[model samples]
Target: MKRLSFFVLSIVFGTLGLSFVSWSCNKKETNTIVSRELSSKKTYLYEDVPFDSTKVASFFVKYPKLLTFQKSIVALYKNRQYHYAWFDKKGVNEAAEMLYNKMSTVQEEGIQKNFPYKTDLDVIFQNSKTYLSPNLDAELLLSSLYFFYAKNVLTGVDEEATKKIGWYLPRKKLSYVSYLDSIIAKPELLAKDDKVVLGQYYKLKEILKKYRLSEQKGGWNPIRVAPDFKSIKPGDSSQTVSDIRTRLFATNDIASDNKSKVYDTDLVKGVVKYKKRNGFKEDEVITQKHIDEMNVPVGERIKTIIVNMERCRWISEEFLQDSEYIVVNIPSFKLTYVKNNRPEFKCNVVVGAMMTKTVIFSGKMSYIVFSPYWNLPTSIINKDVKPGMKKNKNYLVQHNMEWNNGNVRQKPGPNNSLGRVKFIFPNSNNIYLHDTPSKSLFNEESRAFSHGCIRVGKPKELAYAILKDDKNWPTDKIDAAMNKTVETTYSLKRKIPVIIGYFTAWVDDEGTINFYKDIYERDNRLSSILVEEE
Candidate 1:
């Protein structure tokens, strides 16, 4: 495509907070640019004028902190044949101003630190008239800043860095050089396109704005609970109710705060909303635990949202767009089966406890096993079975376990830890979803009692949902298969992608943001990495 004419480019830049000044290049410079452009095979989209190639090396010397982006910067200019991407014969282009504006409000995107050389950027844009013609320093600075924004806001930490921090789900890799081409063609998308970043990032950003606004307003006061009471039941009159009302209203959980001491209907509605938003049991009763959750400072909540936003960057928008898939957010203790870009069902789940934390990863679920034998891992055998066998001769028989080929395997039964079914998505971590005999564990708001695999509270329902379209597996056959003493396995015709992820803050379907406890204490570490990068 031909480069946007200077008149059209001027209008675009003027709209992005930078007035364009038409520059009069000497006849000699114009001829040189045309000769270079004609010799090159690629079409120009941003500017035809090329900058000095050696200055890119000097750019790193002048702004060494942005040296990390040197590779991407070099590739971008090379792709454009060393053209002046952020400038033209008119002045600094629209894409440059858009990037500058994005960096200026970087914190709004959950970034905590300013971009390196932001002051230098500010001076150049502030004095755009002085640099109306192609300037090497401004050109390279914009290129470096684009990569910085792309790294922190678009792609997040590198895959190795994420794996070091315990995130193993596939990271989305993008060609920032190609992305710059598209952004230069249509600069408005840099500010408004949801596809550029994960849709979840934008949703979390909306919540981040409200929370930051709440922080600015001094936040809500902690709801004080009475020492004598375990929970404030409905219709109970107390000051705690009044405080909760104020707190809920402050967070927009309720429409308004009447500030009444009585546990009225409005206050009860707000209580359930607050509980639901905080990944607690949706109930009218207000307990000390709920009070403690409410007492968590808004600043800490903001940090959690910011931390999860970084996680969103590690994800691909296209991954979530798959026709069918399953995702389990460990911190939220919930699993969602999505089909056609909508959640088919969301069920409570028990993830691995703090000791044997479930790994965050992705796999393709290919099989379903009913009345599955639980082949105890070596760790479990060493930790529990060997000691139990030493303590009692009948331990294996009592637990309905047997030695099968030098491995301890629990027989298919109601009391089996695998319950009556298991969904297998082969991974190196050996983590999969399965039914559990400990159904009561799901009753607790914090359900992290498993060893390392996920225990689905509604495995049968999940099976039904997965096989609803299939003609071969009827409900009666599925039920019979689970009740049979012999283990039965069925391979799915179409393997579903399964992603086991961790997010402490998520925006729900109703547009309300939810905050769950950092079950594995991951938020602080991730937040530190982001700040350290800054």
Candidate 2:
């Protein structure tokens, strides 16, 4: 009787232990959804902290107290993301979780004590990585709680982090922050900024409680992906001219020239201001040429957008350390080399025509020259010169072009075609940029007007930049170098990589994905292969 009773007790205890294990497992998950109070778990976004350039580094480092409120933030700081790092799905999930947890731990009170007065998102996006440096500020240790980790893996810290704080609770509900708007056409809460945020932007935040742009189930939105690059095919006369132009000069950067586009004198000039701003001919007429420009295929435009987008993506910038860098928007027919974050030097460039469109690539600024000489490309000689020589026999002499394949070479002269000066960034394409003799084309907008090269808007400034690095080779000497065949290379202390790119749609400085007319129209053909159309 004793043995049977003991066995019964053992069985009962074992069942109780199993029940306890299951209860604990279920409780943790339930706690995540129901137990946490929204008001008790307060959070902040980028606006809570305003920028103060003086206190950068100290604000970005990790603190022992931060670990007390947050465990995830500590794990994130420990992760190392060096180049050539491979990321699998597991890594991505963990990183995202860590981010969500860290953002939740940050409190408004903590930000007030730690950061400079009224810090915002810009300070974190532009300067947080530098704040992580050892040379960081002492004030940051006491006050600043902002820091960047894993390079560009973190960008919208202040604003983005604040939104993430909501994840610990239920996701489908709603947010007071307008940027966190869900299906509702309006945001729960918002700060009045005139730019487009995540969703539900209110125009006059004061007049109305909120205004929202409802999410559409499906319709004609993706049309902007490669937008109709060409007009609705040729000979389709039913379409209004304005409709065609509306899609053509839709870029926010450009405006239509003459609003009164009647089919006479005014129409003859065709979209003047838009054409002019884009470095195209200011003729406002919607002529056959204009139609052809509008008719460029969608496939080519997609290629342009993809290539240029790649260029922007490749730019892993930590901060705008240097105020400016030379930017050559290949498809746009313009060049602006900025300084101190402003366009100090801008020039009209003659880029490659469709047939010999310049390859999208990049290199660095080595130096600029005062007087630069031109070494004509061999391809030009073969394609342009040899054909002309066949007709004129004295073709080489007329253009001052000489050819003796055996131990002799063509020398430079007035008709050499390489113009007075050129910018050099040596690459595999055998394409060294130079000035051109056809200066009038600079006035045209659709400047797909070169034999696969780039022409600068301001040639003189480029000349100054090239030679400025060489102390002995003063600006005056640059002009002298041009007349003489003195081919010299001015190496840089650090050669910055130059990226020659082609993009049709890009987010501007204000973070808006501004679209352009895909001159080449190649996106659809490529995108079809890469993405499913449904």
Q: Which parts of model 1 are misplaced by more than 4 Å?
A: 1-42, 226-229, 382-395
In candidate 2, how many clashes are counted? 63
Predicted model with the maximum lDDT: 1
1-534 in candidate 1: lDDT tens per residue?
122122221121111110000000000011101111132355564456777788789879988998888888888888788887888667888888898998899889888777768889999889989888888888888988888888878888777888998987767756778777667767776775554455667777888999999999898888887668798888999888888889888888889878789998888888888887677778787777888889999999999888888887876544534657787878778777766544566687888888878888788899999998878878779888999999999999999999999999889989888889998888777788889888898888888787788889898999999998899999889999999888999999999988777877777545677777788999999888888877
TM-score of each: 0.88, 0.46
Candidate 2, residue 255: Cα displacement in angstroms equals 12
Model 2, CA-based lDDT: 0.37
lDDT of 1: 0.77
Q: What is the lDDT of residue 141 in candidate 1?
A: 86
User: What lDDT score is found at residue 88 in candidate 2?
Assistant: 22
To one decimal, what is the Cα RMSD in angstroms of model 1 from the true structure? 11.7
Q: Write the per-residue lDDT of candidate 2 for residues 7-106, one digit (tens) a residue.
A: 2211211111100000000001111112122334323222133234433323334443333223322222222111111112222122222333343333
